[model samples]
Target chain A: MKPSDIFPTIRPWVEGLVDVWPAYIIKPQFASWQVLHILSLVVLGGVSILINLRLIGVGVTNESPSEVQRNLRPWMHVGVIGIIVSGVLIGMANAERLYDSVAFTVKMLALVAGVILTYGASLPTARADGRVSAGVRVWFLVGLAVFGLALFVFAGGELVNPGVWHMILAAALIVLIAAQGAAPVDLSGGPAGAGRGPVRGHPFHRQAGRLRAARPGKHRLCLGVPGVDLRPGGLAAVHRARSGERQAGQGHRLRHHPRLGRGRRRRAMDRLRLTHEEGPRGVGPSTTPGRGVRSVGRPGRGR
Target chain B: MLRDFLVWLQTELGKGPGEYPMSWSEALLGSLNFWGLLEGTHLLALMLFAGTIFVVDLRLLGVTFRRTPVSVLSQKVLPLTVFGFAIVIITGLALFYAKPLVYYHNIWFRAKLVFIAIALLNILLFHGRVQRNIAAWDTLAKPPTAARISAVASLSAWIIVITLGRFIAYDWYECGKPIPAWANVLQECAASEHGAASLAEVAQ
Candidate 1:
């Protein structure tokens, strides 16, 4: 349904809210309300980007996916609540103007979808063992794509045709989903590579054991290596394996995980991609190199 | 000499790019659709810039990410923050370029510049004075008073900047508009100076 149709029923409720709000806020040009909106975006948009980055597997590698999620969760709540409060304040104050503005309508729809996508798919994927199935990763990307479209429409103005842009965005997302399909889509239901116990002679487990035997200092040093290649997309499997590698000291081969090195990361990406292309369902030896955990990567998918 | 140079600079800057022989600047100036794209990007970049700073400021105040070393977290987030900052500055310049004279005379725009200068100074002071000792207290649940002070200052400055930046859209001192005396003094509000001339002529 179009936004215009939905607003009439809610108009009275919005007017009531506006009546109780501070008098200063009633003015459409109120500076304080505008500042609140910007500030809330700083919180909401910022945390959303960080959480989404982690979900896709490339932020704060030092922390476990769970740790990243836990630490950022409070801020996420604060941001979400702040945005809603400020958004409602602003929306109520200028309900008529917003009701008429297609940009506002697009923003509201995107906001709803964004909140759900962020909290539902992204946050859960992050909280899950960092080994998300490819299907789950697609869910995260879809949320990002939708949020981006909403932002584009809001910024582009209501006057512009959102229909054309929506179609363009949908096509782009479809391509991304199709590209991701080439990688293994996790169907086992649990974390992509969790549940299966440590495999003997497996790279991650073997390294973890070796590191455990080495000087205590080496464990910290080895852990430091992952930091070397922590680019923005360095999300789930590599990091998850890094932790497993740390504990088992065996996630990578003794030679060192190419994923950990800048030059070698492509091999890891290729391996993940190959898993998508080669095996859609069954787990293979190469399905997850470090301990049966496959995460989103393209750098090393060639192998 | 400096005053003369400043005047000369303003005079030169006032020349509308549209009048240039190449006409490329003019073409860009004439395009409302292009400016719309820039506006979209400017807002997006602001979100990124503001978001990164918010996290870093929180960490400085020792509110969250306590277990992780502050340095590591900073290192990881620095690139995104820088990328966001670069985009904001670029888009901001383009927006300013589109209507230089109007923006220059805008009170809120001036306020935004002042706020940005102060924020930058706050950053410099923190990195110079407080940050040297970061290693000592980076892991603490509550950072030292100095770091906390900088965090507060940075946050406050940025909020003011954002507030003033948004308010810049309001024309507090337009050419034909009757403005307050204080504004007149600050923005050279002599009626003869403004007359009924276009903003491009005023810039010249």
Candidate 2:
């Protein structure tokens, strides 16, 4: 059955909610609900930005992605809960108007997609400390493609009407994705280089290579690569393996090195690992470095 | 004096379909769908700006990020906050320029500006005084009283600003409507020729 057919059946129940005392009291104070809704968005959006930044190797590079997610998860929970509660009140008060609004339908669909992506894809990838498996990455991209197609089909070939509210939602999504992809390239010191190709000539890649050459055994903390291990044991093993090669001739001790601080070390390693992965053979960046290959870098980076 | 200046600006900018019609820039921004985009950008930017600031404020208040050093958290998050604020200011001004007279006569918009001023002053207090000595308490889970107080003030001011901003969309006490005397005086409703005409009607 079409949504047009279903909405009528649901409208009476949804509209009935406003007669309840709490919703009824809030019906007149519509602006208050709007305020609450925006405030909750601030919390949610803020926390999401931080988490996504961590996943893509931008801000708070010192902490593991999991740690940032763990610490900020409570705020995200608060935001989601508050948004839902306040949204329900507002929705009930204006049930009739919303039922006819295509923007409303698009918003609900987008919300469902957002919730699923956050929990299913984003959080899991982050929790794994940015080491996304190839399969998961493929599935995430597939999911996004399907969602976009659904939006297109749902709107009957035209994307949605170019209404202000519709565009706002679309713009927010674009900004979030763009910020994730572009930050590594734009922010000079960020670890993840552009994902599309072997950025061997990029200054960050050169700096990372120099750093790795200077220190053989210690792998730079490359969260962007899949095979490189960030765990303590894996790190020690890589150090042991590489130190064996170093013992032949290159004997150096910069233990007191000013540049070898924890954060710098991690970033250098990340760049070096990414560069190594995108070698002269022009292998693509990891299928799922964190969330998806698209998120890690723009399309057609290999060229 | 302020109302007179605003009235002068409104007149110079012009309004309506008279010989001295609305300014081209104002008309373009006001009439087009682009105005809606400007408003949406302002709102989205406000979320980013306020959200990031609240994170920093929470850190200062010792409400969250207690384990993370105060300096590190500030260093990482403040850049995003600054970026967000830059967008907010640009879009906010564009929005104001689109309807300068409407905003000038709006009580809620006026209140929003007052709180924005307070928020700016609070920032100056923070960087000028509180932050200069950050090295002293850089690692503390709870910062000094001055720092905490600054955080509280920042939060309170911005919350009021956001609420007032949302209230601007409502016409509860619009200029032409019959408003309380204090509100009319605060809004300087008698300053503009239009406002004066409306006030005179209310008096009658």
Candidate 3:
């Protein structure tokens, strides 16, 4: 039920994992392995701090938010690779003991989540236009807080219990960071009255300004609307009116969907009815009419 | 009749929760030769299982290859990962069949299965909501909410599954007292005395 109950049996096995080439690893006399391990720890630890700082908005304040992100981010990945490689090497020196140590597992998870979140959240938007808005910055802070809390909890776990609880906390922290990283960031610039609103520049930012300025058909092009809100039939009515004006001919080059504006589809349906009634004499389908039907088997058959 | 079957199972497959040396289902997995193939395949299966997990987890965490685009990486890695997964499942089944009872009664092993189930369910969500947004992310700065959550869940589940898998090697889950680490000095807890001592300490 408790960790102590399992440690003794696991100790020898863990020792084996850590002691395979004790000369290269555990021997304080060898100095090299310990040095690598410490170096990895310091580097990973430092990067973790910086990334957390950036997340908290305290560290990268001097740089444009994105610049701060760009600089602090790459190190996060390097730190992860270093920690993993070094941790494994050290653990291998005393593989058996390290393998079974709850302390080690907790450390691994903290590192994993820390590296992942730091790298992921700053992943430039695919549009190459992604920028950090205030909301995104807040998520970064959340991630940073979670990461630091995880590290502290993990260190405490190692110092105190090095039991199931420690590993559980570490895992929880890492998972939290990863969760925050998955949020979307809108890179676009914003609309009027940015105050008392959702961070205005994200994907959902208003398309209202241009729609109002539209000289017919422009609203249709602005599918991603930011501020403009239309009532149930408002958009349709507006569309109907603009399309009606377009039919009057201002020589606008826009591809106004005639079908939507004045229900051209209804007229098309009427034409189809006339064609069906008059049959081949109507012209279009009558000219070729599915050649397969006449040449192959049955007439008036469609492909 | 069902009661009799139940008693029979209790004597055999359905042994006590903390039971061990409860006998292997196939004794020696049906002779040494058959067992060797099973073990070898099991090793291969493990690689598959672990590899898919690594890739999926990496993707979820956004730890991607620099040379490979996200969509490309996903395309290339996913198939192998899924293939490896299939190998693991088949191999795992073979191993389990080779000795169902030990696997069944092993508490840590059962816990591993539970985590794997959860991890698998998380994968289902990954496929459903998250995967759908792959094309859209390029146009939009960020993916949708559902994708983000699925990715996080996938990453978390894999970590838990890995941790639990590792736990299988560490925890002495079969015994009531399982005086494992503490018992480094004393292997078993045959008597109630050690269990009582543990019960007291844990109580405190």
Candidate 4:
């Protein structure tokens, strides 16, 4: 007997695992994780859309490019996770059919490229602070474009081929939803980037942070954590600041707290992004409370 | 009655060219070709459609890039839409000619054309008067009821147009034979001789 013939015998349980539910029908097995997976897709999909658009030449006309990247950076994790969850769900639902689909293979490849590009491009350099470089944007765009093209081909082929229109339509709906969720980016005002300044003085950078913080999901909480700052010096500053805020209460900005920057950093020197910047160069978490919001007052205030 | 009418239409339009008011030129240039051109035009139109629809939907749903004035997006994309749709209509007519008497006699096709006309007329009648109200909805979390209705209608009509057009091929129900009437003669001559005898055929 051929090895193939014996394979099923070897893997005894593999043959009848999937019951005869028409593979085309997206079965509604309501696991807690499935709903969470869908929900994750929504959250991460939206964040991915917003960031990808900013990477492209789409929305947020007035904000500096770097600011757009910073605010949108962390949220991309949600989008990647969403894509993974939704992708796996859909793939499992149509495993037999998708296994042979050229579009599926291409999309998988594109997604892999996208993930790699996102990692490679979104790394924060000391010079750029949290803003992903244009080179990063290029890779990000390639990733997005490849992914988008994969989706378009995958979905479009199904329009004329064996795949059901309903599946294609549903997928398209998800795409549009994700697209709508993404924030826009534009180069109309100037080059889509940020410059080096104290994070205090950089409203563009701050605005990016605020946008992530304002997101109505776990992204806000995830990003709101002190150690998640984009700059190397960000985590320590956030840690100290959070401590001050908790100790001092809501109305008291960090300006009231004094001399704790030196004392705290020496203790927590091996910590987060804020470790270096929290030093007493007079712009410590204590000295600078709201000193850096002026540029954020530029034309697109809602940004 | 509607089903019967549709069945009757299918019976009538299945007849060939000599028995119908359709010609080669009419098929190629006059109607079918015209609408096929719309397929090309639709690419541009689809973008504008997406653009306008995006703004309106976002306004209704309350989303971002909201800072760009709603009126501006409407004005920008609406003109492109109109221009694109003109191509669609012109092309649609060409497509209709590709099998005219059959298409003319097909109830579904007739209904589709009627829907197109209705969609067009609706835009003409209400779009201008309603543009301001629609624009105001852009920044609102919940657009005013009237604007929402208009948005819904606008979206609905476009969706219907697309769906019906697709179904035109799928749910095609042609009528039986047609008499070679004067219009049919014009089309015939146009088919055989490409406008050479169309004037005389029309005069006859």
Winning candidate number (lDDT)? 2
| Runs of candidate 3 exceeding 4 Å displacement | A1-303, B1-24, B30-40, B65-72, B138-145, B178-198, B201-204
- For candidate 1, give the lDDT of residue A241: 42
Taking every candidate in turn, the Cα RMSD to the unseen true structure, in Å, is 13.3, 11.2, 23.4, 17.6
Residue A152, candidate 3: C-alpha displacement in angstroms: 48
Q: lDDT (0-100) at residue A135 of candidate 1?
A: 71
- For all the predictions, what are the DockQ values? 0.34, 0.37, 0.01, 0.05
Worst 10 residues of 1 chain A by lDDT: A179-188
Poorest 10 consecutive residues by lDDT, candidate 4 chain A: A294-303
Badly placed stretches (over 4 Å) of model 4 are A1-20, A23-303, B1-51, B60-68, B79-102, B105-108, B132-139, B172-204
Give TM-scores of chain A for all candidates: 0.48, 0.53, 0.37, 0.35
* TM-score against native, each model: 0.64, 0.70, 0.35, 0.37
For all predictions in the order shown, the interface RMSD in Å is 3.4, 3.7, 17.4, 11.2
Ranking by TM-score: 2, 1, 4, 3
**Model 3: DockQ score:** 0.01
Sequence-dependent TM-score of model 1: 0.64
TM-score winner: 2
B-chain TM-score for every candidate: 0.81, 0.85, 0.62, 0.57
Best by DockQ: 2
Q: Taking the tens digit of each residue's C-alpha lDDT, what string does model 3 give over A196-216? A: 222222222244344536655
Model 3, residue B133: distance off in Å is 4.6
| Worst 10 contiguous positions by lDDT, candidate 1 chain B | B18-27
Model 1 residue B28 CA deviation in Å: 3.8
State the lDDT at A117 in candidate 4: 62
